[model samples]
Target: MQENKNEKPFIPTLGITIGDMNGIGPEVIIKSVMNPKIFDLVNLVVYGHGKVLSHYKNLLGVDKFSFNQTNNAGQIRYNRLNVINCVEDIEVNPGEETKEAGALALAAIQKATEDLKEGKIDAIVTAPINKNNIQSDDFKFPGHTEYFTEAFGAHESLMFLCGERIRIGVATGHISIAQIKDRLNADVIRKKLELMLKSLKKDFNIGKPKIAVLGLNPHAGEDGLLGNEEIEIIQPVINEFKEKGELVFGPYPADGFFGNSSQSKFDGILAMYHDQGLIPFKTLAFEEGVNFTAGLSAVRTSPDHGTAYNIAGKGIANEQSMRSAIYMAKDVLLARRENTH
Candidate 1:
């Protein structure tokens, strides 16, 4: 995507939250900021401990990596990586899940969120966090999407997995398979579809987008012999959109849809549940996918994968997804500006 030629050259300041240090968050973050090309697009600021970031810089042996360490975003400089020390100095453990690491992760997110609310930063790109350890009285939500929804004051949010080719959103997120049936309803499905449609038009620059919705059951309930979700609930919603002259179609069998490579036909897709969308998404774009939280008042995104504990600190974790997340945030910020103007 190109910037509007009539508009002034604008660069957004993006805040990066360093997830659990024991994970590959710091490793990928250090690698991403070290590249000089990134500075040409936007100013970078990391929300984490400067000491731990320095430790990882030395561990990775990247001599070119240097950051301006400060506590205030106003002091951030262009063409240099900036570090905001949100947590105190602590031990650097690469692979173990410690309470300290969890605390640090949450601290970075909280500080970044605060800054976003204050307009200290333009957008946020979060690293992977261990959901199990990050749980506390303050963060009782299941994952980032939920926490961000309440934090940013959005009535609803969609877990939209974005790739170069295909983008998929889920109606039900971070829930068990058994609960999928009970959690899904017309209201929830309609809200997710609304978010995806708006995001595609505003954030993706698609004037009119074609959307596909996946069925909850196999063979789309095999004509209601297997299950009635498609016949009873999902189809009614699809028909309602069709009546309004919207380009929405579906209740497609999830297995056959991807199996037949049908995802390429649409601009966006809506899945009934989490695994139904993520499994195929990760398989196709494991190293490049971005998990974007749509329908929020603020811009937020994250790497599609999690903290690879087995490969943590190995310096082998792929930074493509991290890099992609950063670029996506920049793209969305610019797109939003153009739309608002």
Candidate 2:
């Protein structure tokens, strides 16, 4: 049920998938939820094995924390971390990639996704999973964005890397840099812009969002001296939006656009490819960034960083990104609710 605007705020039941138990997924998750204040925001439910979490809880030496162990979401107790067992007696080998860990990750994802579909949970905050290990017959997508996009039957989705100061959406994702030119076209760029526009309005409450589009080549193709893509492909689309009276601009040179911090002038940014946007975003806010999949029918968010295999079980993994993801999921869900009402 939607919360009434005049009523007290409703606490959302947020689901978390313990991604790749061997990595720092479990550790960061535990640390994020350890604070009692989180319970005041939402009902937290984790989809993973109790035994694996117990191992990490002991490894991290968290003695004063407690949680409810169950296979049912309906039995989740408020004010305590609740874990729904998705796998049975899984072994955890930190800093190592194994088929067992992959299976556990997939199981939790499948279970939480099912719950989300059935309205058993409001939204999901996923921890980092090793993309290489989490491949199987049931899961063949490139990453979580693609997986959830397909699962929810969205024609396309945007890999929106969001931080406090800026938000960026990629025109193409999880593809080779060589293939960007071949895959990128007017239709692709237009779709991404549409998704960004709608998400900024509905998910973020930006009624008239100003967006900046980044060029694919050096110096934004230097007026066609560097590349023709900016002239032939990108600018035409930007002009199309402008002709329609939309607040979209650029084919700005990727280097100078971000290098000069021009991102602050717009509400959202559209980068031509992955590394072009992420390298700068991570550099700016790696610890607090949230990777949100926009345009999906349901709300899903994950930490901007991946599984830190080198730091797995080291007791030093930063939980701020994980915490931010959980909070972002709740915020987006609330935004969606408010827009609907």
Candidate 3:
């Protein structure tokens, strides 16, 4: 963790967690940090198996970059990507799942977040982890978002996405469509909206961002013809939030809200559920999209794309999303800093 004293200092210790070893996390991390510009702006602290990083570096053929363990965050070069390896002596096989890799991924995130909570790192950006593997019979958990929320005792965290076009925040995420009916409540909607507004200002650099919200049912409940969630659950929240001086609007129908031409009007959109937000989000921006967890004490982000396992070792995985994730993480860190003082 020791940083180089002679070189210009990086703002925050950007701790990176190599996600599921079986997936594309390691490749993206290896490729993303190779750019000299990345190392110049942030102090990199990576969590994951050292051997896995070695394999990735060898694959990327970065001969000059080396690994060193540090006790203090003062000796590492800001120009050279610094890794505080959290795990060691683990075998890495692409496209193959194992409990050890999954275990290591969680360990890295835990270590990184613990440092962030303790003020060792200013922010954390995670690589993607395979949810299915983590939910195995032996392991009991839903996913990283839920796991981290529980680990930190965070109350009802919000999952939001960042894109080149319109940014999106979700009210209810990572839940089944069937379960969304019971999940939609005025209190939850208001809190998520409040978090979204705060994130727009603090994370996305939006000054008085106007957020367009989507209705729960098709055609925005069609004036009670289709459903009542809009009038009962949604409108109340939106009205109250507007009264609170938040720049928020809608109960806009999900169908007609998207078009290449219509995308530029809104700074952010708040969707009631996952698919409603992600369908338009992935459609509008996929390869370059970044996943950001809003409403956490620590900043966390990841590439919007999933672990493209089929293309793991082919040397063809696109680094755009990972690159975008790092950039967004830095922006959020700066925004958070500006808000504090």
Candidate 4:
């Protein structure tokens, strides 16, 4: 589907949460919004402390731009960078994770999430957060996907990583390798596949998306030689979807799938675990991938990277992934609107 430039554009308001203050989240976000073209794409409301952003702006030598402060989401200034301070009197220490940093990160996310649910913001683009540090009684999910699933009351959500060419959805995310086998089940696989299919059609505007499902074991269990997940759980779901006339295929070996460039043949891919899909995805599209949460009522996206503490305040953190996340969120929001209409 093609967007008509002649039509009146629907500019969305995007809420950005600062993930870990000690990480490269603020640095990358500063670099991303510095481009005037980004302001043209969407009205951005940053949910973090102004002091934290100010420190990064100076540390990174980004002096020409300034964030317009606002106390309310409705007061966001279009065509400019706006900030809503979620914390006050906070000292930012780059390249070090602390309880204060995690607490502030959670505060920012909480505020942004509330605004997103209230329809004050059309979409949300989050920065990287430390899974270990950013833990509290209020925030107890494994990662953002599970948090959003319960927050938005969605039955299921998919951790979809997308770039210009490849899009992958992981069935299980942020879990230990030892727990993967027990977690692999037909119900889980089927729900993930359904979510991926729906997101491809509605959010990506793909009418008939062909999805490739990867096997859990080596050589897809070598026909139950290595494991029975392929035959018992994975293949059954694929067959069920196929019999229903869906363009789904494979319990293909994970190694050959990306090694042989088979990913280019399909519109999307569904992997049984996190590393199986992400390792190949990052290798291929790390610099420009966006982590999109599919099957949520509200759109949310983040850079396909984590807090680069080593490069936090070095002023060298690549902003490409963050920029891609912002643009992807806008595109997905637009596509969803078009789909609904």
The Cα local distance difference test for each model comes to 0.92, 0.93, 0.78, 0.92
lDDT-better candidate, 2 vs 3? 2
lDDT of candidate 1 over 1-341, digit per residue (tens): 77678966889999999889889999999887777989999998999888878888887887888889988887799999999988768788888899888898899999999998999999999999999899998899889999999998889999999999989999999999999989999999988988999999999999988999999988989998999999889999989888887899998999999999999999999999999999999988889999999999799999998988899877788999999999999999999988998
Q: lDDT tens digits, residues 17-43, model 4? A: 989998999998999988788877799
The reply for model 4, stretches above 4 Å from the true place, is: 1-7
Evaluated at residue 67, the lDDT of candidate 2 is: 86
Give the lDDT of residue 173 in candidate 4.
91
lDDT of 1 at 124: 96
Q: Which candidate has the highest lDDT of all?
A: 2
Worst-scoring 10-residue span by lDDT in model 3: 68-77
Q: Write the per-residue lDDT of candidate 3 for residues 238-283, one digit (tens) a residue.
A: 9997897877788888888774345568787889999989998898
Name the TM-score of candidate 3: 0.90
Give a tens-digit lDDT track for model 2, residues 67-174.
Answer: 899778877899999999987678888899998998989999999999999988999899889999899999998999999999999999999999999899999999
Residue 302 of candidate 3: its Cα lDDT? 83
